[model samples]
Target: MTGGRSPRRAVAAADRTRQPTEVRRRLIVEAAVPLIAERGSSSVGVRDVAGAAGVSVGTVTYHFGSVQEILSEAMVLQIERYYAALSETADRATSAAGALRLLVDALFTEDTDRHWRMWFEYWNAGEHHLDPAFAGGQDRRYESWHRQIRALAERGVADGEFTCADLDGFTTRFAALADGLALQRLRQAPPLTTQDARRHLHRFIETELGPGPHGVGLGPAE
Candidate 1:
């Protein structure tokens, strides 16, 4: 009949057929994460996501009910990856204090900047519009983050690495402090630097936990 399809075209068609719906859905979300990170949630659209994912616009629409749905899924993926990486880094440490230090160090670095950006993008969109899709699971995500910090504090106290008088208070304050500092740093409010953020976080840790075996602060930003 007509000229046959090229090997590359045939392979591409075969690959598309072989990819499962779940795999393609995940791909769309993964692609959306970076696009939302770089352009923000309000700026990115389904067309942008589809192009990035190398899938048709129809495929994205088929998988996600709306742009908000796609955005929410992307945010979920971002949070999961964020925690997994931080947990992995902290796991390499020998003690609870060491793990806290590792976790703080990992938080304000370039490696995690994109994650933070994407998080804020989603948060701001949700806050401004009060969209349910953007608002969903936010509290649960924050609780998970708080739990990680609380667990570290509890472990330190148990291991004699920390002498916290109020575990709950310290956990709440520490988590809040980190979030505030990160927001300021991300916004460059007063021109805050990563070193400044890390230093501030470490000082807060030292203040709350006191310098000891259990309160292994990073000392200062070098």
Candidate 2:
């Protein structure tokens, strides 16, 4: 009221000026993912994440509500990044076939392989306590991959780039095989490099359609 409140008021104002709440919350969630990924769910909680995030427990609970909700939101956020990376992979390939190879490589290509590792780390480790909403994300991921397969197949067939007896079965199998191969590579590597997997995908495409005019969605590595 005199010149400007008091010294305590100044500090309170400074505290109020802390970074945008959402930005801080996102940083916390991001930091929490790798933490929760490495540590089991039971061992980590609101206070733990808040401590890791350098925030108070009250802030985390206010933003994320409960542990289940926090895990759910964290997984959803991480998966979006994962799928976005896949989309980038598709956008960079040279043809539908190259795109397919790139997609496989993109999924399993990183040296650290942190992306998929985080996924399995959370998925395998935390599925039991995961929110029911997470189950829908599984279907959503498959549907998204399914759409990519359909687009690739239709484009390939229309241009006479690839042939298939059954688009549905072909697309389904392609998605399944790609996922299976990605998981296998994650589970066991050194023998199965991304290059080797792409090599095999090329052969499969060639055998399927005689290979000539490739489709256009091919994208570079993500």
Candidate 3:
């Protein structure tokens, strides 16, 4: 006769033991993202995230130093996911102009509205609270966008698809235009709809690049 733990119990214990530390950290951050996005980082705490993740407070602190760190990491994770989606859209296009069109269209979708709301909260926190943890978050986000825009512009110029006179100036102007339009779109009274935003951006591209292959609007992807 033998006495041992049941097979199901043993398998359950093995599964628990196999969960990696990195996976646990990611789980915690994933749990925290919605909370921070919906309620703002200022309103979320370690206990809330721990409860959401079904992990103990000590586990959260073990992976992330403090509440501020968790919130900041959550913001970074959201932006990283956005970048991945943008990159995927760009990858599907055959030309730089097509890539730009796809990227702009992706920007105005309903799914990204939550991301914009979270980013707005981040900006507000950085501006009003003078919080050191959030100090450069907004700048970094803009910089990432700028880099992508600049790369796309350069590619277009190299391929002879675009006739931008000043690459740097054109990139900066387009980025600013998108940001301003995004803000307007996010307003409660939203002066511009997603279609309007796309039209405005496409028009600007046409004007800058002149009416050619690069200037042709493909319209939003289905």
Best by TM-score: 1
lDDT of each: 0.76, 0.62, 0.74
lDDT of 3 by residue, 83-125 (tens): 7889899889888888988888888777777787677766666
Best-fitting candidate, measured by lDDT? Answer: 1
Residues 1-222 of candidate 2: C-alpha lDDT, one tens digit per residue: 012211111123345347687876776676566655555455567766766666666777777777766655666677778778788878786666666666655655654355555566556644575556567666676588688767876666776665667778767776666656656667784467777665655545455544435532332323
1 against 3, candidate with superior TM-score = 1
Q: Mind giving the per-residue lDDT tens digits that candidate 1 earns over 1-222?
A: 112221111124457677898988887888888777877787777777777777777988999988878887888889888988888988888887778888888999976778888777767766765666446678777788888889887887788776778888988998888888878877886788887788888778777785456454434434
TM-score of 1: 0.85
Give the least accurate 10-residue stretch of model 2, judged by summed lDDT: 1-10
Models sorted by TM-score, best on top: 1, 3, 2
The regions of model 3 sitting more than 4 angstroms off are 1-18, 125-141, 211-222
Candidate 1 all-Cα RMSD: 6.1
Cα error, candidate 1, residue 163 (Å): 0.6
How high is the lDDT of residue 148 in model 1? 87
Segments of candidate 2 deviating more than 4 angstroms: 1-17, 37-43, 121-132, 189-192, 200-203, 212-222
How many clashes show up in model 3? 0
Ranked by lDDT from best down, the candidates are: 1, 3, 2
